[model samples]
Target: MEELFNLTYKDEVEILKDEDDFEALGDEKYLNHPDMEARLYWAFCRPNGSCEAQIKDIDPLVSIMAFNHSKLNALKRFTLLHKEVIENPNLRVKIKNRTRMLFRSLVDDDFKELNKVLDIVPVFLEVAVDQLKNGRKWNDIFADEIEATIFMQKAEKFIDDSFKEALFFKLKDLRELDQEELKEHLEEIIEKKEKIHTLILKHYKNEVDKWIEKSNLHLLQKMTIKKLAEKLI
Candidate 1:
């Protein structure tokens, strides 16, 4: 029994060490050790020219860093790095180079590390979907429709079914609403149809119509949240 337990313990430790090795390589290869700037650059860049791209690109490195260190200083360093990028446009070339190096390292140094990066994809996807439901701009929600669809496709990976269902229901509610009734509700909310409320209702109606035409339930839900937020603004 003792030998059996020892063997099991050894196997567990080996598994953990393998995980650590993957994480450490990610930190070195992608994050650019001792240089937070490089890390932030890698985190923010997107295939398209936009800073608002979901941090999903760098989430793997970030998650590994968080797991290894779990320290406030590390978190602060990352935050500052992101802030610096936000403040400086001149660093774009340098950042892009770092991203290239990081990608190269994965291909040339340790191909297995590439799998580690993909491991956190589901988690990042969950974050992106949650952001959309929490009222982020439609375009700002996910990196693209592909990412969103990937998340939806892997619904079993989601931990919070209630939240997901709530978002779905919210969208469904919007899609099912009577356009005439929505117009009346808008008038009641703003106390006049000739005011900004009328314009808002018109926009909402158009957006809903577009969603219906496209049969994009997720987008319809997001538009519903946007319409609700406009009422407060």
Candidate 2:
């Protein structure tokens, strides 16, 4: 179903005031042109461009472009960072058991063309990490936001690290579950990040108790042990 939607979206070439016969032509053109090139063609030539297409419920790329600009930029930056990470022989094999899509692809010595997946990573991460650094809510991060610029409507793990892992397999033309192992590795990374934030939010009763037993929350005197633990967990 999603594939069909993407195909339908790819068909909106030079949006017409009701074109007569060009549906066939556009279909042929799309079929012949590479998927990425065809999508780019629609963006540059369409009326009101990607903006108008989206307004009329046409283009979908605007979702990733219209609002989540930071994520897109981050992915491009990540490519550079990733290139550095891969060049280091010491770091190359470390994430072999990891799950994050981009990281897994970077480590894979045989994988080709890193650019295709770079654009999607940061866009997906924008929401997940938006709350991480800001200490502010979505209303603040996305305040005065333009809907046409955003791709997803709500925040969830669906667009998280696992998707990128799957994409690596697809892009590499290697059919199998090499990425499943990555999940355990990424979970370890997330767990570490959570430990630091636990101090702030004080979630997890047992973990907080363990930290408290170890004098971890001694500085947070104002917070009741239970209240503090809830945030850390």
Candidate 3:
């Protein structure tokens, strides 16, 4: 097993080195390379000859290699070519599994780095629902007020005097909540506390729409509007 692992690692390294050489020779040479053609085919072509894998088990280095060797047109092509892979149920499951494993491995010092990539709105909603149901305050569940505010802006529809007072008291205590545990709690909230759903959806729709417009997120705008309309049912 050790020898096999080493061999696989060496192969990966060679592929990366070859990719660098191909890239330096200009786009024409890179595009004409037999190895590039083979790698693209293997990465994209479906096992059953039906559809390509949008998300492959290939290393990130290989993906970066492809990116460096090609232009935006190539990147766009690669992205579109793998759409089916990304949409595949098995691939999504694998992605989720890997993501959970990675999240679990994060240390205390890694939280800042993790937060940069995480879309905290959903996480905040999960936590907020838990706090509201348990009659807890935001400060009781979060360590940072700025983080709490960001969460509130994304998830909360109304911040009344009572809620503010409760949050203020909790802030003094400085407690922390697990995001995943909060998600599980939110499932219960969805079933037993339907009113919160309306509030959450309302908040999500209002804030996300404004954000999409400001950011010029045309695709997200269309999707969010469609979802908002569907929520009426």
- Candidate with top TM-score is 3
Q: Report how far off residue 199 is in candidate 2 (Å).
A: 5.5
Score each candidate by Cα lDDT: 0.37, 0.33, 0.35
lDDT of 3: 0.35
Instruction: Tell me how far the alpha carbon of residue 27 in candidate 3 is from the true structure, in angstroms, after superposition.
Output: 10
Using lDDT as the yardstick, the better of models 1 and 3 is 1
**Tens-digit lDDT string for candidate 1 (1-233):** 24434453234334434553643433444343344444443333311222222232243443222222222221222232333342344532334433333333332322233234324332233433343345333221212222222334444455355545433332223444554555455445445433322223444455555545655346656566446535533
Give model 1's TM-score versus the native structure.
0.22
In model 1, residue pairs whose N, Cα or C atoms come closer than 3 Å (at least 3 residues apart or on different chains), thus clashing, are none
Residue pairs in clash, model 3:
54-82, 54-85
* TM-score for each of the candidates: 0.22, 0.22, 0.25
Q: Predictions ranked by TM-score, top down?
A: 3, 1, 2
At residue 220, give the lDDT of candidate 2.
Answer: 51
